[model samples]
Target chain A: MDEKVLLTGNIAAAEGALYAGCRHYFGYPITPQSDVVEYFSAKLPQMGGEFVQSESECTSINMLYGAAACGIRAMTSTSSPGFSLMQEGISHIAAAELPCVIMHVQRGGPGSGSTQTAQMDYNQVVKGGGHGEYRLIVLAPDSVQEIFDFVQLGFYLAEKYRNPALVLTDAIIGQMKEDVELRTIDFGPTPEDRSWALKIHRSPKGKSANVHSAVGIVGIYNEWLARTNEKYENIKRDEVRFQSMFMEDAELAIVAYGSSGRAAKGACKLAREEGLKVGVLRPITLWPFPQPQIEELASRVKKILVVEDNLGQMVEDVRGAVEGRAEVHFMGVFSRHMPDCNGMIFPDTILEEVKKLL
Target chain B: MSGEDERKLICDTPDCINNTLLPTCPGCLHGVVARCVCEAIDDLGIQENAIGVVGVGCHAMTAGAVEVDTISTAHGRAPGVATGIKRAYYGEAIVFTFQGDGDLGAIGLGDVLNAVNRGEKLTTIFFNNAGYGNTGGQMGPTTIEGQVTTTSPYGRDPAQSGFPLHMAEMMASLRGCAYSARVGINNLKNYAGARKAVKAAFQKQMDNIGYGFVEFLCTCPPGWKKKPDEAFHWMEKAMMEEYQLGEFKNVDEIT
Candidate 1:
């Protein structure tokens, strides 16, 4: 059973790492989420896990690359610019089909943007965020409890599919304090299972001839890409996770994720009080996003408003899934002239748009 | 050198291709250096525990040949990658990065320095062939004195280009590395030294002593626009002047 306790979103994520059997934590300390490192540094070794203060974000993710290659669960957590440095390594893992988890608690920016929170990296996270044809199983957990649960589920899906996984939160979710249950889930693989990892070629059973190489060359990569593409298709077709509130026969379907998801709840509730016949679809897993369901809902609802911090990134995905079945309006406060990271898209800003659209 | 001396050296003759794959240009010096690393891994009987971090440049092609657990890293960050791999699974595998001059010296200087300074328990093999061959020929950070390439059209202007960097020696100054040595791929004496460095790097990794480095000052005849024999002769006389061979640091002796 998960015990109810208050935690900063960063600490909640650290606890999730422990519960999920992810014993290796490799990352450099960055702002707005340093408590994750601080919490895991003390807690991991206590549980006989390994925690490393790597030289940089690049080294941390690459370290995850090594650990995950051996089929062991591994992860790294970072903020904006550090996440930027980690993209190259993330690309390598994605190509290799190595299962590693990354948490990006977005602060603001194109450079060393800000230590404060914002949901600006939706495009970077959901669209592979690196070079080549790849996608992470991006999970958006709005609540502190969901943050803990998805960190574990993210590891399971990553290992099952042999792909990189992501838990995306902004400062809002990463730093929030709320009651969460610390339930133990038996993930069934210890860090010791990765004996060969990057160093040796061994399955848990013992000595076996290992192939260090994976998809990179043309013929080989094509075969792997075919397999990866199938997996991508499966995720889109099979996994469509979301939470619904008053969605039945709703005339307006408001879609959001992460902080916006929380904000949309309030918006939908207000619209309901006014009897405007509105409902909300808040996606828990952001990638292979809940598109088909949104399409189904779009047929009944006249308009779908995509409320996000950045300018209309996810609206395109919603529009593509619906394919002109209905009109999709974007309630985005996009400060394109300034920069993606520094702008603000307040919950009220989205609420005001909802008022006008209805 | 006589034919008898050539027999003793471990060269990458076409007769000696073991795997159906390899990681260097046809007849480039990197083939010899790679074979030495392979031999060291074989001799230690750690192929099962070996992870090779292949980087861009000539070594990018090496990802296919290496039999051990391998991951191709971005340019110049092989050491950083290997450091993570090895540390997260201590005693589980032998981790090393294989890199060339353009990838290591030109663009990725920070990665090497930081890895060395951190004393990460890993091995690094640097193939320092003076000019860039993967792309169009250009003067690399380890380009020899008075050498001509695509970038330096009128021969390397030492007055403007400055002398080449002696990387192992520079790394030795950090005082955190376990072993540091520079060798060559041109001849028997230099080949032996290079192999010895390769072996030492592996041994240090097994011992958990600390960071280790082996620099192979190789030759690129096709890019340099010369016959293989002439390239070796050039490396013999002047390459040594700019980038010296022999041990820069021996941590075992200190301990």
Candidate 2:
């Protein structure tokens, strides 16, 4: 049964993960993401699951790795600094091809910058944040409901590919409350049943599971590269997801994702009322990025405006996706590694940029 | 050949050693340590139910020879991994960690301490070979004063490198630790005691006792830049002098 309720993005994500069959939750407290840890800590145990308040983000990620290696559905959540500490474990889990979900509620930083919401981690989440050639199935959710919904999808993609999945949201989306419809989903087989997981039910005759990253083995890495590359190519071909509005006959396409995309939706309506024919293209998956849809819009639209809260990170990918098919303009507001209460891209601000291009 | 003598060759029951040839350099104590651990698991009759979490360095190779379900953890993260495994399968499986001094003492001290403090029911077999054997004898936390290593070619200075950490003594101080012992493997006499200590550590975990640890003062011939026989003599003379072989904590006294 689906029930309607008011929930914050952080709470929604936790509830969604629970419904998706995440039985093990491990995390350390980080601002903007602490609600997730708190929620899971209380709720998971009540539901006959396990929760561990880890000593550090490094420990939490490795705990998730250990649980996932045994084919258990596990997760961990963090903000920037804590998430940064998890990179080493993430690399190990990826190399071992374990399935797990990690949530990073974006914060401002090169170091311990701010606990405020920001979209600066686009590269860190989509590209490999850790060492070696690895890819995480990254989902960017704009609304509280989507944040709830995408967690289930994140786990699915992780298990589907036997790799890690990340739910990348920022402070605004994570903290903001909204009415959401929560539905319980049935989770699939444990990864251990598929013959790759570390067999938990050990018998004398069963084969022992050998899981390692082989981080610097040149010969072994080539084989890993070939297999991972093929999987990523298939993901690129099948998983590129985007949503567009007012694109039916618009002359300009506004590109954004997550909260910025929500702001762009409002800007598109404002531009259309002023007879500017602006449309919005919001990407749902940051990696396997909505390239083909951007290509289609590039052919139809005369110009593209890419807006973000970061100092022009995703615009590079947008430009590459467009590939000179249209003139791409980047409109990003840079912050001083501090929280931006009003630094988020607003509808008026994006409209102003679109009007300038018009 | 007498028929009675031919019938004396019998191999049965506790198939302790793996069929594969020992995969260690000649005269390395890693082989001896591996044999002792496998023998302990066999002696306890928990080989089928045991799970091994192995750390990096030469100790990582021990997993291949271990007949149990084994997972090689990241360098210095075996205790953390073992903690997760033990918690996930709590009271269902026997979990153990095989780690070297560099993996347990240097970068991974926190993981071991926290797990022990939480009183995780797992056995830890610590190999204090004094230096990082896999990385060509670099200085480690257990590297003794006045000892020569790749990073401390001028000999380990108490001022520069800090005093060698006695992990068995440190772990013994923790209230959560049910048992902690330091044993050496140099002479035939010490080997017998070392086997007893290893067996006791495993038996404690089997009894659902908390956080048992056995620190083995083993030899690294190449790391020490000595011949096999010379390494044994040095272990007897210097290493044993610094790391006393005795049980520091027993469950009957601690808990």
Worst window of 10 by summed lDDT in candidate 2 chain B:
B11-20
TM-score of B-chain for each predicted structure, in order: 0.87, 0.93
Q: Compute the lDDT of residue A214 as modeled in candidate 1.
A: 36
Q: Candidate 1's residue-wise lDDT over B1-255, tens digit each?
A: 667756765544321124645545545777677677777766677766777777778766654455655677677777766766765675467888888888888777887888777777788888887888888678988887677889888878779898787889887887668888998867777677787888897788788877789998777777777788887777777787778788988786323
Residue-level lDDT of model 2, residues A1-358, one tens digit each, is 5689999999999988988888788899999899999998899778888788888999888878877877777899999899889999999898888889999899888798777777888988888889877889889999999998889988988888888999989999999999999896555653445566555556767676666766454127677888888989998898777888999988989999998999999999988898888889999999888888888788898899998888889999989878998999987764222335445667888888888898
lDDT of 1 at B214: 91
Candidate 1 CAPRI category: acceptable
Please give the lDDT score at residue B203 for candidate 2.
Answer: 78
**DockQ, per-model, please?**
0.38, 0.59
In model 1, the Cα lDDT at residue A73 comes to 70
Best by TM-score: 2
Considering every candidate listed, which one attains the maximal DockQ? 2
Q: Provide the global lDDT of candidate 1 against the true structure.
A: 0.77
TM-score of chain A of each: 0.89, 0.94
Which candidate leads in lDDT? 2
